[model samples]
Target: MYLLIASDLDGTLLLPGDTFGAFTKSVIHSLNRAGHHIVLATGRHQTDVESLLDSQSLPVHLITSNGARISSACGGLALSEELPASVVRTLIEETREDTDLTINLYCQSGWLMNREDRNLRDFSQNPGFQPTICATENLPLSTVQKVFFFQRNKDHQALTRLQARLEQRLGSQISTVFTFAWCLEVMTRDVSKGNALRQLADFLNVPIQACIAFGDGMNDADMLAGVGKGVLMGNAHTELFQALPDAEVIGPCTDEAVAHYLSKHLLQSTALPA
Candidate 1:
């Protein structure tokens, strides 16, 4: 039996619609009814995810802040990893002089940004969200989960140059993933949805072969590449699709394509009704 279904939110499982399509919901319910666990792994923090859960009604065990934190839906916190205090201090010091970029920091408590950062200011206006603002130069030297560099209209050359520079300075000690074309995320080398999934799979006693993962961003690439069955949204970046040959490529989730594929190939023969 299929044992686990782990998917990224934002652009993969949760599309533009305020709600999941009926077929997708049914497939998810069917999977749950069959006793498989569902996990929502994303760059979002706990509060952001909780708000979405309340609006969408799809309860998920969360692997948030790109695996910096993990918690069950029924209210028990399980695991979390934080950047070393030294590393967090170093990162904050390195980026302060660069005013062209805005920084977002994720920690065990929640997300932090400068009060004047327009992007963050607008995001905070949305109800049920809980991000705190603090001075970049005065940020707490506590552990951090990830650091985001948010910029506007960055080109490939600019992004490549930045990534190359970061690699030269930090090497493999830091892991970087781009959740959106305009944003770059830096986390500890050992943290990712893939690593988190490995831990979750072990906890559930589910082999990799019994799992399927779906996603649409560069951050989702590693997990998609490593899983037994990976599904890439048709609208995902072209380069990402080329990097994972074994992944099942399908239409955009908004088209109900993911649900159709799951229902037709995975649940048709063995599902118990929701």
Candidate 2:
């Protein structure tokens, strides 16, 4: 049976250093040729995810900004959930003095950051997908889809504290999830990969039970736990495994595990008792 397959970008589909393995590309192509649906659900801005895929056009749908925004294969925006402008401004003002945390805004147009991280532009064949350096006070809050708190040094403790603080302060006013140990993302209270995935399945008239997804981060938790088949990377965050203990743990992303698994199930023929 055909299925709708979704994958998270950074730690699930892409290799370290934000690169795609050739084997992954081949598998994606084969899956497409076999008529299965492919979707890339990521916390990244759609442009950033597009930068990685370049010209492949593998995904039938793109879930960007941790599900704040979703786009169809024709590059048309389908759904968008924006955070409250007042809340965005309030958080920026409150955290403006925190020097250790690098704040970024995934705006409707492009990525805006308080400081410049030049390494973010590496190897992207798409020259237009660069980060825009901006002062915290001048962020286009109304158009911002996601505000992310990034720990440049990858400090887990700092992230944990920040996560707690945000949850306590915002309560149900906003939603926050850690896309990576170093990156905590805040969005509209309704935003989540799982919610978006279910919406897409319904829009396309497909059953949610026929959808399978893969991920390796806390932001992926909702979708992983909600899908029919949830595959967690062997190298996924410890909390992720503990949270979804029943999920199928596959090999590490470094090994192109998603591709290998798809190859086995999609290419090889199935057998039944005669």
Candidate 3:
């Protein structure tokens, strides 16, 4: 039976430095060729995710910005949710000068920043998402899909503090999580990778019981838990592993573990509905 195979990009599909190995390319290509659906669900912006798949052209769906935006197989956003304008304005005003954090805005206009962050431009693809450093007052608040904060050092303490601060102020207005310890993401309370996956399944006429998802981050928690089979990488963030302790644990992403498991399923035609 055909199934939906959704995966988060960073820590689940790619190897070190945001690169995919040849094995990954081959397995996904084979999977798509076999008629199982593949969706790139990620916390990344559309341009960044697009650049990563520009060469492969295998994805049938795209979920970006931690599910704040979803695109169809034709590669245009079909569903989107924007954060409250007043909240965006307040967030910028509160943290624009906070040197301890690198704030980013994923807007309909494009990926943006309150300040320059050369390090975060680490994607290994052209036409990639470039950080457009704009003045805090000039940020396009009305069209923003997701807002995030990060540090090059992957500083957990600072990000933890920032999460607490944002939650204290916004409370139910936003959903917050660490896709990784270094990056604290904020979206409308209604946005999530899980919800996007469900929406995509319904759009494609696939049932949730026929979906398998893989990931290794807290932002991925909902997606993993909501699927029929949720696979967690051995190298997943501690908090993520802790959150989904019952999830299937596979080898590390660096070892191309996702590819290996997928290949077995593809080759053996293992029935995954559980």
Candidate 4:
């Protein structure tokens, strides 16, 4: 059977300093040798993702901008989902009062933000990162998949309050979550990592029942619920684990538990029953 393995990047796969552990790399190589598929599903844009992979010389499919875009690392095939102009207009109007907050709009062309947001400027300077900034109102709305706010400090109370206000006003037409204390993402009502993973399954001609997903954030919830096997990081949130109690909870992403699990189960054919 063919296996599809998808995971989030920042807090889940790449640790502090944009590092990938030795065991994880070894397991990923083994999985690739076994013909399994590997995918990077992240809140980054295509350019940002491409540059990162290019720097590391790793080849994999990508689901970026919180499931708004899908592309192959081999340099072919791409799809994007964007909210309607009316929705974008409403979002901008809604955030008008919060000048201290920095907002970023993601589209096929690239990332956009108000140039005056110093925090945003700092974030864009991250290694191998580059984003295009254009007028938000003039952006091509059809290619957009998500909007995000980046805060400098890990102020949970501020993030919670901001998310709450957005939810109250947007109601069911929009979905919001904080992937990290510093980042809050808003997606279209129908967009999610699960949806993107399903799309990827179709593109790769694989069954949903044969796919495995790993994550450690609220954004990972739907992906965890939708896949055949959902694995959470041991250090994941209590509520996230409770929400998917039946799913596998491996050790923290940095611990090589995912590698251990794969080595013991999927990597060798002898593990399969006769």
Candidate 5:
């Protein structure tokens, strides 16, 4: 039996509009009661993740900022990784000179953005947290968790080209991945959902094979490949499907596939056959 259930928030656990249905909530509560640990592994910041789960308190371990930060279910920071000051400075300077992308930096204290455009405003509203507007050079780089680049024109091809260029320039100094169509995330090279999950499993004294995960983005590829039973949502990126071809495929997130899968498989069955 799996000891832990880790799920990505945006497109796997929560639906398109960042809403968590009652059915899903109830299932998670049941799982918690049944002695299974529940984890919310997301590309979001800690504040954003907490805001989304507002009022409805559940014991959910958080792996936020695509795994740059980890906190206990009760909201205590357990582990956090920060990008080097030099790296952050260089990246910010390069981004300013090389691209028209709207950039946001997440620190341990709060989110920082240079301007409040329509896209940034919409994103802020969704997360229910406003960013502190500040110059890129003035950001608190010592505690930087993650840097996000948002496409103003929403051109997938252009974003792809930019990502490639940034990766080539940054090389192994940073890790870059796309969490959404118009967004690219960069973090410390050591950070990833897989590494965070492994750390959490160690903290809980649970083996890696006793964990299960679900996700649907390129940022989630490492996590999906690392878990014992990595389930990909039907609406997942084609690249994810191609990369993890052997992973189980479930219905779309809007259909409450995680809830249904849990109900029919993990909850109902005694254990997965050897």
Candidate 6:
């Protein structure tokens, strides 16, 4: 049987403000040697993800921009989905009416922002790539892959209201998902980690039932449910548990749960009979 191992980056594989630890990297190398595909599915852009890896030579597939783009481990683009230009214009117009909202647009090239908002300032510090300050109207709307709305503080109510408004207005034209309490991600309606994983599996000639995924956010729900085995981090959002009660639970990402779980279970397991 062909097996695929897919995992989220932040809050799932790596702890807050941390990268892959030594033991985790060693185990990933072992998994790769053992003939399993490793994939990094994240809300980050491809450039950001690559920067985070630095000189690390891990052959890992990438599902980036919250699945707005998918690339092979060798850096071949497999899929690229962008929100409609009309929808982008509408979002910019409506969101400009809200003083509390700070928007960042991500394209295949890099990040773009209309103003130097405090939230953008904080994000730029560790975003791996800096956002180019430009007018929203000047952005390459046709090439935009994803849009991020960040609100200051943990204003959950404001985010919820914005999400509701966007969903109501855009309807089936776009996809909106909250990646954090104060952040909402907007992409094409067809973009999702789950869909990206499925596409990658098909391209690699691996069955869906041979895939396993690990994650900790609401955005990960579809991916967890779509895979053969879905492992939830112990510190996962409450909504994830409510959405996937049957998913296997593991220790928090801070504890290097992924390494431990792989060493104890998957790495030692034998392939099923053909």
User: What TM-score fits each model?
Assistant: 0.87, 0.89, 0.90, 0.84, 0.92, 0.93
Candidates' lDDT values, in order?
Answer: 0.74, 0.81, 0.82, 0.74, 0.84, 0.84
Give the Å shift of residue 76 in candidate 3.
Answer: 8.8
Rank the models by TM-score, top first: 6, 5, 3, 2, 1, 4
Q: How accurate is candidate 6 locally (lDDT)?
A: 0.84
Clashes of 5: 0
lDDT tens digits, residues 4-40, model 4?
8888876678655557777777788888878888898
What range of 10 consecutive residues in model 1 has the weakest lDDT sum?
117-126
Q: C-alpha displacement of 218 in model 4, angstroms?
A: 0.7
* Winning candidate number (TM-score): 6
Which portions of model 3 miss their true places by more than 4 Å? 74-77, 118-127, 151-154
For 162-268, candidate 2 gives per-residue lDDT tens digits of 87887788878788887766778899898999998888777666788878899999889999888778889988999999999988889989999998988887667
Error of 4 at 149 (Å): 1.5
* Distance from true location, Cα of 273 in model 5, Å: 5.1
Model 4 — TM-score against the truth? 0.84
User: Cα deviation of 10 in candidate 3 (Å)?
Assistant: 0.9
Q: Put down candidate 3 lDDT per residue, 1-274, tens digits, no spaces.
A: 4389898888779887677899999898888777888898998888787777787666568999999988988544499988999888877877877786778888888878777664565532334657788877787878889888877677889778877888899889998877766777889987999999999899888999788898988888999998888999988988887899888899988989988998887646756435
Cα-based lDDT at residue 274, candidate 5: 23
Native RMSD of candidate 2 (Å) = 3.1
Q: Look at candidate 6 and tell me the lDDT of residue 53.
A: 80
